[model samples]
Each structure stands twice: as C-alpha cells, then as structure tokens.
Target: MTGADEALARDALRCGELTILGRIRSASNTTFLCEAAWSDRIVHCVYKPVAGEQPLWDFPDGTLAGREVGSYLVSAALGWNIVPHTIIREGPAGPGMLQLWVDQPGDTDDTEPDGPDLVDICPPGSVPPGYLSVLRAYDYAGNDVTLVHADDPRLRRMAVFDVIVNNADRKGGHILAGVDGRVYGVDHGVSLHVQDKLRTVLWGWAGKPIDDETLESIADLGEQLAGPLAEQLREHITPAEVAALRRRVRTLLAEPVMPGPDRHRPIPWPAF
Candidate 1:
C-alpha cells in the first residue's frame, strides 16, 4: 500500500462510521469482522475491543491492542510489510485495535487446502504433487482425511519475523498469501511477551544461517528500537517489553541463526 493509501485507511478507521459486521471467535479476544466507511470509500477491518479481551496469565490484561500495534511498528522498522496496516483507535465499543483487512489476490480461487502444519486438512488420495502429508484424521462422518502442506518460501520469511517478535501464537490460520506471492501475517495480539514463549508453525528454516540482506535488516531494526522505534513503542507497551524487544534484536543479531523450538511447547494449540 502507498503512503497516501495508508493514511486514508487510517483516517477511515479513526473517523469513519464503524459498523460491526459479525464476530470472529479464536482462542483469545472477541474479534469482529467490521467495516468503516467514509465518503464513497468502504474499508473492511478487523476490530478487537479492549472490553472483549480475555485476561492472560503471563501478559497483562487489556494490553493486547497495544501489542498488536507494537508488532506492526516492529515489522515496519524492519522494512518488511509482514503485518497489515494496523492502528490503535477508539471505536464504538471503546478504544481497541483496528486493522485494515488485506485482500488476498486470487484468494477466492485457492481450492486447495494446503499449508505448513494442521490436522485433517484434505481428503485421502488427493495430495497434490510436491506436497507432503504430516498428519491424519477422520471427518465428521468417520471418513478418512489427511493433513498436508507445501514448502513455500513465504513461510520462511514469516518465521524470521515471528522469531524477532517472540510471537507466542503463530497459528497456521494467521498466514495469508497474496497473488503477488507476498505473504501477509495477522493476529499478533499474543506476541512480544518478555519471555521465551515463541510458539509457531514456521520451523522450516530452523538452524539456517542468516543471509546478508536479512542480517542488515536486523541490524537496522536494532538501531531503531534503541532510538525512534523505542519512542513509538513506549506509547503502547511497557518500557520493559520494549527493552525485551531490543534484547531480542541483539540476541538474533549475535546468534544470527534460526532458533529451535522451546523445550516445553513449540507450537500453538489448534495449529490452524
């Protein structure tokens, strides 16, 4: 999206008429499929109100919205459009996280049910070429089904971003692909915790050496987190969390390698 497009989108989110379309239920907050309108333009957005968030044991309550924005800021500082255009603003239900819904190019044409990790993904004897089956399950009628995913490089990039943010719930369903071959990641409210709770499904590039370009990006972000990015992030998350982000940047730069899974838990629940 262009700068003008992003500005307009944010304006629509901040000042347009917000109409709640419906509800989107997940593991945490009460999500909504909403639309905001302004002068002949209508933008669909994901709305998560503060009042609807479920309290967590590790992370603070009512701060998920801020974390969502923080994730975007980190991605922006890295110079990668991994997350969508997100903003924190007031809505009808009170202040919350409002993210512009991204359109997946040719997304409606994706008849294939394939990705990195999941259970009971497709029907038996229907695995596509170059795809591998990882798990199996039974359909509701007791019919057999198999889970499969293809090796997409987009996921590898996402994995790197997730590690940088300490994303705790990188479920398969959060990954979205575009017709331009660019993948956009969503649902970042459970991320940036000041802990080692990095659970995700994009472990394909584990232990891989960091490329020069990616390393440069990491170094650039580290500098920003210590400077301007730190100022922007302090508006949303705790000062300690921002410090944790800087620490994560330094750790990744020093190690310069993809990390293995945590000993306790490496993947999110309901993986999709």
Candidate 2:
C-alpha cells in the first residue's frame, strides 16, 4: 500500500470515531479491539496505549513511531500479511495504529480444520473462547524457547520477521489462526532493538539447521534492503534505523543458522 493508502486509513477522531469492537485484558496491557474506516475496508486494530506493565516492556514514552515503521518493514520484507494498515492520530496516550483485522480460525462458520489446542493465555476473567488469538502469548517472558513454525511457509516467514525485529513477546496466544488455515501475527509494539532480546517459544527450530529456501529469502532480503526496500522504510524511519535493519538482515543471511536462547535469554516476565 502507498503512503496515500496509509493516510486514507487514518481517522482524526482517534478513539472516538473508531468503533469499540471489544477489549483484550492480558498480563501486560489492556488493549481495545477497535475498527475504523479505510476507504471501503474496515480495519481491525488493537489500541494498547500503555495500560500497565506485565510483559516486561511497553511502548516508548509517547506515540511509538517505530511500530508503524517496523510493521511496514515486516509486511514489505516478507510476503507475510501483518495487520498495521494505518497510523491514526493519538491523544496523550499514544498514536493509534490501525491494523487489518484478521478473522479468527476454527469458527463453525468457516472451513479450516482445527489444529492442536492453542492455549488462550488471557486473564481469568478476560478472554472468551472463539475469539482469534495472536501468535505470541502474554507472560512468555520466562518460558522456555518455543518457535511458532508449523511447517507453513507463511508461519515461518512470520517467525523470521519476529527474529529480525528482535521481538520479545511472541507468546503462543498472539498467534491467531484464521478460519482459512492462515495464521496472523500481532502485538509488535516493542521491536527493532539493538539488543539480542529474542524471547519466544519458537525454539523448535532452534539448533536445527536453517533451510535453503529461507536462507535464499534472507539473502534476497539483504539485497533488497540496499535497494527499494530501504527506500520504502525511509518514509517512516530514519536512514540509520533502516541501516540497522539492513545489518540485521545481513547477519541473518550470513549466519549459517538462527540462534537459540541460551543463558543470556531475557526473563520472559511481562513488564507492565
């Protein structure tokens, strides 16, 4: 989507104009399920304006411009369809980023067969069953290394995207399986770090060898970084940030295999 598309998706009213779809109460922040108009399409989004601390981290002090840029990079880099559709105006809390709403999987009305029991890590009185879940889970700060790949290329792409961003809260709950067997990833506010803060359960592939296809894609991404991809991200992020992302891409491409969590792994506790 062009910057114009991003601009059109914005709603000046922020929280007021958007429809309050629901609320997600997790160990970290209290997110409002929101929807706003973007041309003919209605975008689904989660507005987490620094509610509290639990997942060990929250957005920066004010509007997280980095998230908008990171989401754009992930969506553009890999063919994985991440949500961040638009960046809405913010009040004192934070800028509301509009994301594409993905329909939850396993709905009776849909056709895809069910997979294993994906746990809903919502608080006791919070989550209702049948709602879609993000691929990452809450409170996964201290959990053992668990990867999100299920042999699906799309899912694998999502994992690579998270790795590049140095995501810290990729809990099992954040991975939402759509009714069409497509998984959707969300909750990427705290990313693009210079530290090795990789803390997720997607460790099944850890210590395992990286496949040639993914390796090739990583190489291609590296090349793209110095080309058009870099240009695209320049609109939302600084050139230095783009350069840093390119460095990460190069590291992933040059490395023989992806790294797994070791003694230095950050405690998986939420920072609410």
Candidate 3:
C-alpha cells in the first residue's frame, strides 16, 4: 500500500524506456498502460499521446496533455496531491502526458451497483451512507440510474479542487481509491477549460458552505494562482487558459461555497 516514490516516478517518466503493455480502451483518448524502466527502478505509468487525443469543439486541439499537467500543478498547489505526479514529455508516440499509476483495492467496487441496470439506475439503496446522489440518467443500455459521490472529506476537497479548475469531466471511474487508502483523481485532459464547463460526478456539496479549513486552502490556492503557479502554468497552457484559471480561483474565493452544476449538462457520459 506504499505510494510510489515521486522522484523516482518523475525521473522514470522523463528518461526511462517505456514498454507499452497495452492500450486502455477509454472513450475519449488512446491511453496506454506502460512500464518505465531506468537503472534499477521500474515504474508503472499512464501515457496519453497528443496524437491520440480526440478533437473537442470546445477545447483547443493538441492541448489535452498540457491540461493534464496543469491539473497536477493545481493539485500540488492546493496541497491536496489528489492527482498523481504527471509530466509532459516526449515518448515513442511523440509528446504525451505520463503519470504514475495508482493501484486500487480489488474490492473498491464493492459499493458499485451490479449489472447494467443497477449501474445505470444507481438507486439510493445502492448508495452507501455519507454519500449523495447528484445525477440521474439512463446509460447507453437504456437503463435508468443515479450518480452518487461520497460526502467524505477527501471527496469534498476534490469537489473544491474541481470547482477551481473547472473540471469538465469527473466520472465515477476517474476517482481512484488507492491501495494505500488514499483517493486519487485521474484523466484530467478534459479539465481546466476556459469556460464554466464544470461537468463532474461530485455534486455532494452543492450549495453547502465550504468548511473554514477548506476555505483557507482555497485562499492559499487563489494566492498561488496569481503568483508563481500561473507563471508555471503558462509554460504548458495558453495565456488565455491560465487567465481563465485565475478567474475561476478568484470567483471561488469570493463565494467560498460549493457551486451547483451547469444549467445545461452537469454529468459526464459513461458515468462509470
């Protein structure tokens, strides 16, 4: 259950030889489960190539990997470390976002509703205590379901992080329950959008007052957003996107509450 050494993981991601084990068949982009080896250390990492990124009308082209890195920077700035150590570096497939892989418990899905129907129609009965149902819809299989997220403190922290980043996709599958009993968030390529496109599964704190400690964290994030963090982000993302992130941080600090979902669409597809 020990976490991977960040320095070792980052070094491997940067210079180690990557052996692609196989492609993880995600809906949006081509993701590879890879092993990076250098010297005596080996690390497992997720690799998302810029060439494999699907075009989105809203976000700029070939910028997903940078957004992924940007999310990592923001996660680090907030002192949450919810995201794994991620970096943008050249790979066999040109440039990509390489991140350390998180190993989750085998029974992490114990609370997940079984079958397509049960999964799609996430009934309140299926939801564990201390979680809230924020979304309800029918899956591609046409089975009705509800989307629920934990009201746990860790998830609440991520909710605030997502709000600050304007995370566009936060599916249930994207939330990782690490073997070390830590929660991790992955697949941030669709996050940090310039628009108010905060589509996510974490709506448990909507309209709720953010706790004082969490607000302090947000305040620290806001200050960093205006200073060195924005400068660092500029090296990866466009000036416009950096400015947009700054705006989001400012607004969140001003309100200090869990904002509701978008008026049009609130949840990501294939909510698994």
Candidate 4:
C-alpha cells in the first residue's frame, strides 16, 4: 500500500469503531473478522482480543496480542513492510490486536489465478526450478514429498526477520502474497520470546551468506533496537526479551550467515 493508505489504515485501526462480523473458528484463540470504521473510511481487520487468548505453557497468558503489535513495530523499523498495519485497541471482547486485513491475490476474484505460495510441498526430487528444498518426508498415503520455499529475495528478507524476532510459528499459511505485489507475514502472536524458539518452514536459505543490501537493513534495525525500538518492544515483550533481540541482531551482524535448522523441532508441525 502507499504511504498515505497505510497511514489511513493505521488511523482506522487505532481510533475506528469495530463491529465484529464473525468468528474465525479455525484459530486456536478467539479471532474475529471485523470492520473498522473512522470518518468516511472503513477497513476490514482481524481482531484477536486479549480476553480470548489461549493459555500456553511457554508464553505468559494475556500477552499474545501485544506480541503481534510488537512484531509489527520491528517490521516497521526494518522498513520492509513485512507485517501489516497493526495496533492494540479495545474491542468488543476487550483490549486486543487489530490488524489491517491484506487481500491475497484472487481472494476477491476466483477468475484471477492465485498468487504463488512462497512455501509448498512437492513430490520427492521435484523441487521447483527457482525454489530451494527444505526437508524430505512422506505424506499420509506413503508417497514421498519435499518441503520447499521460493528463493525470492522478499522471502529471504522475511526469513531474516523471523530470525530477529525469534518467531516460534512461521507456518506456510502465515506467508501471504498480497494482491498489491508485496509479501507479508501474519499470526505473530507467538514471537519475541526470550529463548531461542525459532520454528518455521522457510529454511531454504539456511547456511547461506546474507546479501549486503539486506545486511545493511539488519544493521539499521540493530541501531534502532538500541534506541527507541527497544523501548517500543518492551511495551509488548519483557525487558529480557528485548535484550535477547539485541543479542540476536548482534550475532547475525557478526556471523553474516543464515542459521541452519535446530537439532530438535526445527520446523513447525503441519508445515503448510
């Protein structure tokens, strides 16, 4: 979206009146598709109220919504526009995360071919020409399959972003190809933890040397985290978590290489 459009969307999310349209039943926590209206503008947004957050053993209760907003703040600092315009506000279910909805290609028109999913599963030894293989496995029918993600630079930037945020659930479904020709990641309520909880499906770039331009962006983000960004993150995550984020950035800058999968639970279950 253009800068003005994004500004408007952010304003709507921060101050608009929210009307819940329906529940997203597939979500583990309570999620609603809603309309946020402000002045003469109305935008569709996803609302996940703090009151509806599911208790998790690893994450503290009632903090997931704030983490979502925190993820957006880091994304903005990176200047990558990887996350949608998101904010915290009081909704029908109480204080929660309200994110501007991104329309995926073909979401509103079936005739338009759907955008290519950055991550996918294909038959063994059949990875796409421009894609990179992540893992080899078997499907329910006993057929061999390979997990893969595109080698696109936009997706690579997202992979690096996930590393910086310590994202614990970078599922394939969370990588969105917006109709506006931008890539976006969503469902970041499980990120920004103090420990190394980097679970994801975008392991195609693992072990590769990061490009210089992206490294510059990473360096810029590192500087921000030392300043206002650290304070902004502390509003959502703990002080220790913010400190951990700075450490991750510093480590990446020193190494300048993508990390490989963890020995245990490297990728999330139900990879798609």
The top-ranked prediction according to TM-score is 4
lDDT per residue as tens, model 2, 1-272: 35564455444223334666777765245567776654465655656553333343433333344454566565656655553443445523455454555567444465655543343344433433433322344445654322233544555566677777777767666677765466666776666555566676455455556678877767777777778877776665556656777788788877856666684653244322
lDDT of 3 by residue, 1-272 (tens): 33457677778878999999989976469899999998888989999998898888888643888889999999998899999989988887988989999976554465553333211245545765556777666667877766766667888888888888889888888888776777898888888777788887788778998888887887888788778898889887788888888888778777877898757888777576
Which stretches in model 4 have alpha-carbon errors above 4 Å?
112-116
lDDT of each: 0.79, 0.57, 0.80, 0.89
List the candidate 3 regions with Cα displacement exceeding 4 Å: 1-4, 107-121, 124-127, 139-144
Report per-prediction Cα RMSD to one decimal: 3.6, 7.8, 3.4, 1.4
Compose the digit string of candidate 1's lDDT tens values, residues 1-272. 66787788878877889999988865367888899998767888999998888888898733898889999998888888888878888887988899988777454675664442322267888876655454466756888887555555556667889988889988878887754456788999988888788987666566788777888999999888778789998898888888888898899889989998646778776678
Candidate 3: residue 199 lDDT (0-100): 83
How do the predictions measure up, each by TM-score? 0.84, 0.66, 0.89, 0.96
Compared with the true structure, model 4 gives a TM-score of 0.96
Candidate number achieving the greatest lDDT relative to the actual structure: 4
Give lDDT: candidate 4, residue 74: 91
User: Is candidate 1 or 3 superior in lDDT?
Assistant: 3
lDDT of 4: 0.89
